[model samples]
Target: MDNSTLVKPFKSINRWHMLGWLLVAQVMVAFIGRSLAPLGVLIGQDLALTKAQIGMLPAALFLGQSIASIPAGFIVDRIGSKRLLLYLSFGLGGAFMLMAISSNYFFVLLMVAIGGVGYGTMHPTSNKGILHWFQQKRGTAMGIKQMGVTLGSALSALLLLPLAAAWGWRMALLAACALLMATGVLAYRFYRDPPSAEPHEPERKISWSYLKESIGAMFRHKPLVLLSIAAMGLSGSQLILNTYIVLFAYEQLGLSLLLAGMLLVISEVSGSFGRVAWGIISDTIFKGQRLIVLVYIAALSIGIALMVTQLPEGISFWAIASVVAVFGFCISGFNGIWMNAATELVPFKQAGIASGFTLMVGSWGVIIGPPLFGYIVDLSGDFNYGWFFLSFVLLFVIVLLLWAKRLANKETQHNKGV
Candidate 1:
């Protein structure tokens, strides 16, 4: 219970080992959440869903996460991360099981939305775990953990889509359920709270008064607010790309379903590398100057968005894949950096709540961006317009990033003067 006892076990346990398990946990959660994406075309065709509805599926999933994220963050701090991760794994498995049995469009929506409840806990809990274990290399640790997300997403696109094509979407969901159940059991067996993490005190109940104070504190932090805004744009762009890219390739470019899925796999694989590379850059070259690195990455993302809009006819598969890889590298890479930056803006004790608030608020972009992109496609009969719209969103994000950088600079100066 004391600090010495807490520090003892952590000395014996390798931090990298903890990071690997956390990565696996993240992959399981991301796979369950993103499993619905590559099947969008098939599911849309089977259920007579419109473009707008396909977009709404991810929205529903993120909406559930948005609702639960803040509360989950608070809970992680109070109860510790290991048990929450176990519950999340089981919750994701149950949600996928529901998806496998779903009979209609609404049923699928309901189940996917419910799955977000587990997805909501992912960022705060995993980041808390990383922060607890690796203070000296927090950015690198976060990036490595976040790679699980892109890796899971890539694997789902590569493997599950083919499984769906060969078998059925239901079978794919069932297979995912089996994997998730196994992940949950593994987490329960091996996941442990870091020796440095705050022990859960049984006497203190989480109450409304505590919730209000914690939230209030987060809002009072200006850098967190600005960082959350930037996160909104980043997440929005990433979600729009992930949710629609396969369908766009299939419908607009006249690619086969398999080919389209391969394009997505390319993006996810590049994104996995991007997360680690960018994290190392932030940790070493920038020396934890996260926002500066974020701005550079965001600008690169905008360039890719413009390129996506300008693809010529008769492009080769590898050519298109190359473009998508750049898009993934720029847009999907900065999430861990964003999370690392947000946590640094507050005290260690407040890290979970700050992360929860940032994620909860930033998730609105995930909620709104995809549906809006889909709606634009429905209106214009062109996916180019959707890409353009995302470019515009990134432009606004650049402004916010600049503003955040200014604020960060002023804060440093003020502290030095004090």
Candidate 2:
């Protein structure tokens, strides 16, 4: 692949405008996924869900993402991101609306899982978009784009909680579904693929042999494999915070539902800012050393998580909020760096597949983390157990990151010697 193809500006479309819609798409999909953060209590009560069952709600959504992610990556690399985003966004929104009509927990779980199929498209499609659009400040651009996830989660709390309070959680989901589909339509109308330096073969063709080679190569890349393992820990920590923070504050701290939910908003809002800050740090201070930043994030996550487990019952609400804010900033703010690192390990043409493959592995954390945390909570009747569990997960990830950094350093030295 020609290196010059990586950064060519489009004449027909403004890259910044395209970035805005990509952010909108990211925010809306995340808005749907994190809806459970605020509405979990109401939904659990209405559906008579057990604690483990509540955790399964988000887990099921990520299950669908795990299932479809690799294939979605191939499709995005083949078909162009705009078309896939349009299709997946509309389909995902419709799947979410199905929950509005059903009161049965299993039925709603099925809908969320089905919607997860669409959620699978988000990272790959948006990643390829950013890769094609910006290169000089790619870290900062990716960070701004990745902020959609936290921003969406924060918005879900801000907008949906009030709507859920006024009407019902189902109504809140319906409103989210409507907005997501509308945004998809606008994205389709406006988003354009960036100009390619490889004019004859801008997009790769999909074939069984091609898929096999890409998959095999991805697994064989030691840095990618190690990073993928670290990604699982990051994903686990992130989902745990998104799934349980509100309830933890409510049940453990004896805060009101509305007030407990605001903790989620505060955490996600801080996470939203952290995404941008981490990106700038990577681009400037770290000079593209993303893995070191991730290592730092994991270490910070362990410290904050351990601290959470040790907090006393009578702690002030503001103090708890401050802790949640830092937790979110560390745990929720890692995707941009992780995704950028994964995509960078592969050819520019295969960036979508690399990201998809990485997320497929990471989605296991999404699938297992929440339910496991909830199960531990249920068994012990203590939210502290869940925090301890996340701390241990991140601790293991820090070890993996150290190993990856060693491998990267060796590879750099070998290249220099050559």
Candidate 3:
């Protein structure tokens, strides 16, 4: 067999080296996101944040994400993902450095908010890169790429938490800054706009007409629209699980910090493998069914509910950990499944924008999930309320899925009549 016959990476990563590069880039972004998470409690103490203000950290990121989505999508669609990533990687890294030096919490929060803009760019850039190049095996590639996020989340346990413990959370910010700068350099050299035989093609310059049409098309897209709504629901469920899992294990269940951390590590590690497993299943077993989105949603709903309803009393510590592992596997599966469905919505030309739109839509849950779950805990005086909240949230997702199925049926019938 001729080596020349092997697949080519679209642009800057034409060589076999690109696969390794893409994986590296995704891992870097995910690690940064996950590492910042544990700092929530510490930052709250330093900044004198209330429950509401602490909730604002994730909200700030998601809000900045909402603001950046169209612009980032436009940038990705027009200039390409590489330039955006370049700007973002450096911008976020610098923001981290500033975060290290700031005395006022308001100033520090502003810097973190600025970094959120950069954080917004990662998903679009990674999605565009892998999807364009590995079109046929999209799920496999995205699965591998998304596992970077899972691994990065796992790594934060070992890397960022220890560093924070040893040398203050502020110093940890500086270290993350260094990593972001390094990522920018490598991605600049190695990343490319997922090249097409068609990147810069002539189109009617951006007009109200084009804007109206795109929005109209996206809205008119029954499955895509429904999935967008579903994404928000399931992601909310995930937030409930993640936000309270540690406390649920430690404070609620009386596990030690070491044990809680170990459990999180296991969940994350299993999540990494889970992403890959789900991707393969989506590709081969599901045969690209639009319905798998709901299936995964349903499974996650049940798994999370099981841990909430059963584990506190009946199950041993190891069993609780096992339940968490199962929840991680079931819920995390949606990351790829959702993206894969979004890819099928538009032709390759508009895929970036379409994917970005749905992502921005789904990211709404990231903004909503924590606070909502937190509210329930406050109201009920228990994190178990958080789990019950997630179950109801999943119920909404099932509602959306049934709605999407009806639309899917309608579309099929209309085409048949024609």
Candidate 4:
């Protein structure tokens, strides 16, 4: 397709409308995938699971993402994001329904793992859609799309906790399944691929060659390799905080479950704002210098995490809440920026594959971090060590980002010389 044909459809449609639907799609998918975090306490109590086991729940969900992300990216690029989104909606609903019916811990893990397949597709598909729809203000667009994740998590914390508190976790999960089904119907009715994003021809024969080529292209890209490493570290720390903060508040800080849930809601709400704010900073204030913004956010996250570890005994609720909000803001802000950075590093056609590979590497952090955090808590009898561990992880991320920045500068100077 010519550039004019590619640009025409976006011109006809209100880009904001496209962004809005994309946000809604992200919210619904995230709600299904992220429900486990809020339900941790109830699931633990009901199933007689240890802290470590509860951690494994999110791990399993991420493990599924890790397994499916790269392949899903290729599929999304070839089949178009709209078709994959429809499939994702159904997959999310089915997984949640299975979770609702499960009576055993193993069965619950199995269900969540299945749900991870849906979670795995989210980043690549959403990023691809946003790149197609918004050429300018891409960072801001990415932030808006990413806000769906925090909003979905916030909504779950606000609604599901109460619902589960009254009706039980199973009922809450069933309700989630129903919502996902509704989202699926809406997506089927409205979602469309950008006119420019014509689906690639269907492969008559699937082969290792295609996979090898796609994966090799990503690995050979220097910025992508560095960014993936940074993503891994940042993602690990984010998961640690998201998965453990509520438990930490309730168990270590002597807060009620309702209050803990409220803290989670506050964190997510702050994160929602931070995502947009950081995007604007990257797009405008930083003049598209995404790596600098990413480094700043990661450093800020490490500072906040360290602060969490140092909270005094008998600290006030507002005091703890403030720290959590800052932590949430900084930690949640970078993903959209990094994703935008990754997309900028590659050709438009390769956006899906690059994002998928980057996210696949990052998913390992999600898979391992939560369980490790929980295990550290199990051993130490507190969240202090867990918070400290995350700080160190962020420190590692900063190092990788700085290295990537230097490499980027070298490339820029070399092109100038040429």
Candidate 5:
């Protein structure tokens, strides 16, 4: 009856195979999660939705994730990643597939929110696996795994937009659903926990007090709180790009939908590399430090946000894609480091809870960011103002990171004194 008994035999799988399957799981979920972004224009036109409503599509998905994140973490810590992933994959894929039945805006919104529950499961699940399999190269490991998000997003743009252009958005959703379901089964079959020879411990019973203690400890650690909040800022900026860049390119820059989608693909590809590069930098250049890399990410993101505001109509497509590629590299790529820093603040056993808590907080950014950006664009009748808002948010993030670093230093000193 115990999960330990079931999972024991699977533990012999090489850790690299575990990592590979983890990446596959990541890519599948992300592919489904961001599927709506590239289709926003088509969905909007088909459904007769407003700009704000378009933003709400992705925002609604995030709302569901925020609602489910901590609970999913609890589940992961209890049942273990492989079993949980198998269940959530079905939930996520089925919910997204249901959207194909409705042309009604509210109905589609509801489905996206439901699918988001499944989408939220990946973070804590993958983080738990990484914490278990990787002892020394966590930053690098996390980075490699995190690439699934960007790679998946790029693939959605590369594959889904063209498919949608030819058949329809609903058809594209069906294709994504098939891939997700298959990936889930394959991952369950192949991905394994570290061998029981590696000092594996049984998971604790699901307990409210344990959850309460995790939240309490997270807040009490000021650096962790600040780090979590900074995640909110970065995540909001990332969502804005995911949700709006296609529309922005099509409407403002007068590019065709397919070309605008190409910009998104470029950004995502660059971000994929950035995830791995930032991880290696943290491990080698910063000597396993996280905050300093986060600081650089924040600063660079600010510069890129400012540049996006200045992008003019009639700019060369390659030129615009180049800027977007750089933006993606900074804004989209920083999460692996951010996640590594947040999880390290707590004990290893609590990695799932820590990941869930941080992502729960970050989900708020995803929930609010897109709609707010949409509202600003709707209000000012220009996408630039929306970007200006993100620049300010990132500025606030830099301040939060500095304060977090200072608190972390003080805590280190206090412990030394004790």
Candidate 6:
């Protein structure tokens, strides 16, 4: 069915519109992941984890996500995004519940790693859902959907610390698990994949022929590669912000631990709305051109600059939060933009794999950038240098954005009627 036909069914009662609610479910899952950061200090102190051991938790998740992304996308095509996310959310929720009860570091890592493997399915599946359901408004649809990550993390930051304090870390993890399980139940009930116009996008399936074609097509697709590169630059910069801002605030900005942690939470929370606002504005405000990417990069750069403009005068917590929020918002806001862009750039057949490929490349930045930022902080004796590194990364992103714009325009014109 075409867009018009799809719209007709939902005109009356979308009481729990599958797509909108699915987005909410995704946000909740992401929130659980994001909320865990504040607990790093708590986990360290309570569990007697050293810095290296504490660092391993985040790494564990990243590792699982990185390893699983490609396969997750492939599996998503066969199994469906809803089912994939349900399993992951369920696993992670359970893992957190288990984490609440155990203090053994290895056990904690194992549980989190298992949870990470499950959580890995979310990005591609959620992005694919937007592509399937909101074809014309893909960019904005995706932006709002992608906001789940920032919003979840931000919510976790604001609530988890206090909640954990009131109860305990274990209780916090169990609560997160419960929320995810609820989301999974909702997904199983309501979500349905849209029927593809071409049953198999390439028209024939069930053979090595499809595999060979996908590989050949993947290698030949230059635009997606370039998009991936641009995304990597964006990811690199954001990774720095995500990983180091807390340390930067405490050490370089001279904020107390509690104040700095709050700033971290604020940044993530700002990211959630930033994603929705920017996504909406990109197509509506920026004219759906490649220019939107540049807009995002610019937003991110400004936010980073605000964070780094350290005078001897102390920064207020709210002032820092405002700056951090802008940075977090911009850093995360563009995720959906690129996710949407992939559908149009690649052969329709390969669009589904785009999320996996893009995330795999983008996540390298996350894996590598944080530690590098840490190294810079260690070397310069100030956090200012880390912000500069991110600033530099954004400049590279600008070039990619411009290139992507040109490519997007050319393709849109070429395929105007097809």
Poorly placed runs, candidate 4 (over 4 Å)? 1-23, 70-86, 122-145, 189-214, 220-223, 283-287, 343-353
Which candidate comes out best when scored by TM-score? 5
**Could you tell me every candidate's TM-score relative to the true structure?**
0.83, 0.83, 0.81, 0.82, 0.85, 0.74
Better of 4 and 5 by TM-score: 5
Candidate 3, position 19, lDDT: 51
Clashing pairs for model 6 are 31-152, 35-156
State the displacement of the C-alpha of residue 366, model 3, in Å, after optimal TM-score superposition.
1.0
lDDT of 2 by residue, 151-258 (tens): 888888988987898898888788889888988888998898865524565554579898899889889878889999899989888988988887887788788778
Q: What lDDT would each prediction earn against the true structure?
A: 0.85, 0.85, 0.68, 0.83, 0.85, 0.69
Separately for all candidates shown, the number of backbone clashes (residues 3 or more apart, or on different chains) is: 0, 0, 0, 0, 0, 2
What digit string (tens of lDDT, one per residue) describes model 6 on residues 223-298? 6777778777777666566656665676566777667778777767666666557657767867665356545655
lDDT of 5 by residue, 313-355 (tens): 8888998898899998888888889989988877798786788
Worst lDDT run of 10 residues, candidate 3, spans 1-10
> What RMSD does each model have against the real structure?
4.0, 4.6, 4.9, 4.5, 3.8, 5.7
| Predicted candidate 3 versus true structure: per-residue lDDT over 176-209, tens digit per residue | 7788778778878876654451334555477888
Model 6 spans > 4 angstroms off: 1-24, 44-56, 70-86, 100-107, 123-147, 182-206, 254-259, 277-287, 295-303, 306-313, 347-350, 353-355, 378-381, 399-418
**Quality of model 2 by C-alpha lDDT:** 0.85
Span of 10 residues, lowest total lDDT, candidate 1? 195-204
* Tens-digit lDDT string for candidate 1 (227-329): 8988998998898889999998898887889999998888888877887799899999999999889999988988988988888756788889999999988
Question: How does model 5 score by TM-score?
Answer: 0.85
